[model samples]
Target: MFLTRAPFRALSRQFQQSVRCLCDKKDKDVKTTVWPPENKEKRLEDWKVIDSTELKPPPAENPITRTHRILKDDILRLKKYIPGLDGRTTRQNATMWKHTLFGEGEGFPEEEFFPSHCDIVIIGGGAIGSSIAYYLKERAREGLRVVVLEQDKTYEKASTTLSVGGLRQQFSLEENILMSLYASDFLRNIKHYLGDHVNVNFVPHGYLFLATEEGAEQLTQNSTLQNRLGAKNILLTPKKLKDRFPWLNVNDIALGCFGLEKEGWFDPWSLLMGFKHKAQSLGAEYIDGEAVNFEFEQNEHIQIQGVPSGEYNSTNNLIVKLNTGEVKRITFATCIVAAGAWSGHLAKLLKIGSGPGILSVPLPVEPRKRYVYTIKSQGQNQPLFNSPLTIDPKSTTYFRCDGLGGNFLCGRSPSLEDEPSTENLDVDYSYFDEMIWPHLAHRVPAFENAKVCSAWSGYYEFNTFDENGIVGLHPYYHNIYFATGFSGHGIQQSPAVGRAISEMILHGEFTTLDLSRLGFDRLMVAEPMLEQNIV
Candidate 1:
């Protein structure tokens, strides 16, 4: 009982503090339930009752936002009851609230239901989809009915929520630098775009990328490209790194590139929420369901069977099948495939790109798992004072403050071995101990005794072709535009990519920025737009 009560009260106090920050819910009745017993059956009984009635609204607010908060509350409460398990279990339980929220006896507003049709439908309503919706509606002249289809209503499994939220313009390629530069500007003026009421908590402490002697030339070249694109990057020597960041162990570091101004981390969930709420306010309808299949109209279908040479025409119409057993036949002229890791699978449904010797370019995007660890630094000797996002390029290790004092976030670069089951959202605690901790401790010796509070795994939409984003319309399916295959950098690149896609939809080409280098033509011709700075 002591074990259960202690954690519950602590969590409840933290919850109340956090809730005070949310202005919309401050006036409303939002209940935080706490159970006395540690039994699963008793906890479930209480949870069911609270979830059914606690969120009943009097004062109007965003339903999805309200639901997310409530589910998060329940996750913390339930996590306290489960005993003798690892902290990662709490993270996993917290991530699966969609299963409980949208289950029996829980439902959303009628307007929030999966619509039958719309003017524009964007799949995968994560950060990218939401951003596109926001931009499209912001620039729309004729009130275009934009709809976003997201399978995870709570966004518990989405990479946007799980990401470390580091934004930087330091890149080996010119296109990446330009995209990140646009993102930096957008993030700075985010309030003007996302409304004054919302705050994303952008921390521009800057990013420090440390490279060994072997990687110094490429790092220098990257810094040059970044500088050419108007980015404020300073090449720091080992002594400079030590002076700037006293806690850094720069013994093996040959050279470091630091973004002085617009490179840092932020609250990813807040940015996503801002985009979602703004898009919703601008009349973009968001649906909750998985996109299972695609239906192409006969006019849109190709005559590969009859002709000696299978010449492609265009897709007259597309029908998207939802997991909830609803089929939507789109009468709209355009559909944006921004499904991230699932984009390749979605493209396969249209039969645009599949096997060998096909004229159409294959979106070689696949899910690669990456782990994020949350740790609390205890000792006085290990003080991380206002540290920027520090990365060891050779070791593929990175760490930064988690906004909460004494707590820090860290992760290691995903190698080829990390590529496993796409459905696996479970964290590998062993990986932190075996792979991550060793390298991180070597880089920052203080991390040797750091306590891992919690951890979770996220999937990157890794593009095997170039490891860069694939944007623009498909050559075969002109109606279908792509904003997917951003690999791991989707959250930081969402603003620029979203704006570019919106421009393409509104003005028929990229007006604001020329994103042609990330087009489908590059993928088709096997021209890889390589981005060497990947972490």
Candidate 2:
């Protein structure tokens, strides 16, 4: 019921009252750290006890509203005060909180016309692009200019919006683990970076990766790597896992690596917006359009557009063609292709990286489809599922409770085939019945008869070459850079990648973390930095 289309405005209003009451209390000795309870005589102080009839209006009982009311009452009872607050201040806070949940009801105004020239232009306006923009603004010298080109301003098909929003340091590669650690730290102190006006509701409950006998060795190895890279993860035996989470069926599990802290899910779209808004505040411009073609200046069969100190060359300039039939030629000092799933096509348009032919050295990123499902069990058991986000390595199936007790959200690994187009957002019903449900039911027993509520699909900027992120400048094109090929782990790693790219642009190398391990040169040298934990 919590995830349904039903509006939570009433609950939101009541919660606002509770927050105001907490803030307005004048008692210095009052304990504000705890949430107060309501209806103590009926033992409804926790607010978890509710029947179906309580959710309807009039007789529509507004269960969430009741929950908040009881919570406020408990707080007042604890403080030995009346349960009320200043009405005006309460209304103001309520309005602000409501704005945070549902936006201010404003539309994204179109960028009327394309710019003739700019210092730097970034393709794509998703999380990565926004992060780059924010970081560049934060690091650039005065008079620095930046523009972002986004085909879809609504972000309906953006991978960041479609992501499951999972953040973890259970990666096999050290760089990957480090990036996640950076992300966790950034997320924990997000208010300091993005301002107090924004919050992504990051819940660091943790992640549990289960491995059967066949994959135990690799899982163990990954756990060791993660721990060596300063991650707080521990390898759990079947007995330990069962002792911790009795809801999970660990009968066939050989090993499980559980993150003790600094890992979990959050609202990715909010984070993206925070980046975009902050970047805009710093004078970075975002335009709604698509990049179609690129024109390069050459002399004596030598590509000179991106080369800074080449001998056989001319003045470096490029004409970028947009889908709106307008082409602008400018000598940009640097350009970054931060496009996610469509990075390959953008690279093909430039044809500057390494491969067989000029066209062969594309970014190697493709659009791969992944599905997510939401379901709820009919069982009336109290807190039917209480565990970390669990993953089945053998089946590549992972799931977690969706904050509504019996309701759960689940997904599996990427499909074997690549999607023909990046625009496809349709979910396949058969995949659940045939693939995900069986594995989930087997692992949790309680999910055997779960009712499938809804499903959706999104594209991953899958890397055909190494499946790891590419985070540095191009090998051949000196000034051209890339921050793509994250396969499926871009949202959590965006902050680190953005900071690395910004450092590269400013100082010609990464200063904070050496992300050179994910450089384009690796692909050229036939040495891929293979990562074991992809899910």
Best by lDDT: 1
lDDT of 2 by residue, 298-393 (tens): 545555433434333232333443344343443345788988987876776665453333224557887787889998876533124446788887
Cα error, residue 173 of model 2, in Å, equals 0.2
Model 1, stretches more than 4 Å misplaced? 1-115, 141-143, 300-328, 355-360
- Give one digit per residue, the lDDT tens place, for model 1 in 1-535: 0011123333453344335335433223322233343322211112111122223324665655754665576565554336334344654544433322323232222332333335688988889999999899888723466878786768777889988888999888887888889988888888899877667788888888999999999899989878888899899999998887777788989999988988998888988888887786656777765554454434424544332344444442344444454444443457899988778777876666753344345678877788899987665446464788888777678888887578888887667766545556878888888877888777777777888999988888888887889898877665788898888899999999999999988898888789999998887677888778888
Q: Go through the candidates in order and give each one's C-alpha lDDT.
A: 0.72, 0.71
**Model 2: lDDT of residue 233:** 85
Top-TM-score structure, candidate number? 1
Backbone clashes under 3 angstroms, per model: 0, 6
Question: Lowest lDDT 10-mer window, candidate 1?
Answer: 42-51
TM-score of each: 0.76, 0.75
Clashing pairs in 1: none
